[model samples]
Target: MQPVLRQLPAGALLFHRNAPAYGIFRLVTGRVRLERVTPDGTTVPVHTVRPGELFAEASLFSSCYHCDARVVHDAELHFYPRTALVARFRGDPNALFDFAAGLARRVQGLRTRLEVRQVRAAAERLLLFLRLQVDAGRFYRPEGTWKDVAEEIGLTHEALYRALAKLEATGRIERLRGAVRVLRTRPG
Candidate 1:
């Protein structure tokens, strides 16, 4: 199947909530943010799609998008037709297995996020998120801003700041310009 390429500028809306589910997309370059916006304009980020990852897979069976997808940076993507891909999966068991594995991983990620949200203490939640990042090979001496980190970890900016301050005071983390380094962590 020939994939359609789309180039979007930063901040462009690729798909909005309740919009038609055209196809699944693979981010070829740059970043995309998938979020659910409340009626009053509050945005709750669901996931961030990076290069080589697929998004909108749930749309394969659904008629409409459950959330909005917006380009966070200038991005290029390839869209695979939903029906054709579904047909291919039906024809190839190995392809279906691989697709199921990918979906499972996405589900596991959501489960972990849910667990993080359940942690009562802000510090523990932050630590758990950092440890998870480290385990995923996504943490490298922390190049992301604290605000971005907070958002990704589902913490309010103020709460994250307070947690960071406490962690720093306890010698658990060291903050640097545009980055945070985890020194050590212990159960609180």
Candidate 2:
């Protein structure tokens, strides 16, 4: 395990777009928000991180920040220096596999998001996103987004509502106003 150098309180933006390369973050406590900004400078909440999750480690390989990381709740995190992490990652073959696996997951996650955006039926895309979230054990409401659900799932709000009704009718999932709860885990 990496050493924790500091504890940042809630609402802290760990790294702004041009911030220094701080290696990988090993989250030991609380949550982090990964936000995507639009061309008009509108900040959209894309993902919420929880304890035992790693973020920004991809930056270790490239020595650059890709997205803004903000703390959603108070958190204790390791602030590994980029040089050290890179050296260790290169030296250990096993570690390299783990790193590669992680990067693959990140890539797959992005691909899923894009697929959700391109899907023709709102119900199908919404069903897929909920299954992915449930698989990750993440609940979306606390992150302050359900609207982003409609937007990112590439559905009009009315379409998302209609899809929810459809899913509920089939007993595939249950929809609360701010959240979706899985009735059964879909096979991977």
Which regions of candidate 1 fall more than 4 Å away from where they truly are? 9-20, 28-53, 63-75, 134-140, 143-147, 156-162, 173-188
lDDT string for model 2 (88-147, tens) is 778897987887998899789779888777767788788887776775344435253666
All models: lDDT? 0.85, 0.76
**Who wins the lDDT comparison?**
1
Which residue pairs collide, candidate 1?
Answer: none
Best by TM-score: 1
* Model 2 residue 187 lDDT score: 82
Summarize candidate 1's per-residue lDDT along 1-188 as a digit string, tens digits.
57899999999999999988878999999999999999998999998997888889999889999999999999999999888998998999899999899899989998998888888799878877777766432333544467767776788999998988887788766777645667754559
State the number of backbone clashes in model 2: 0
Q: Which ten residues in a row have the lowest lDDT in candidate 1?
A: 135-144
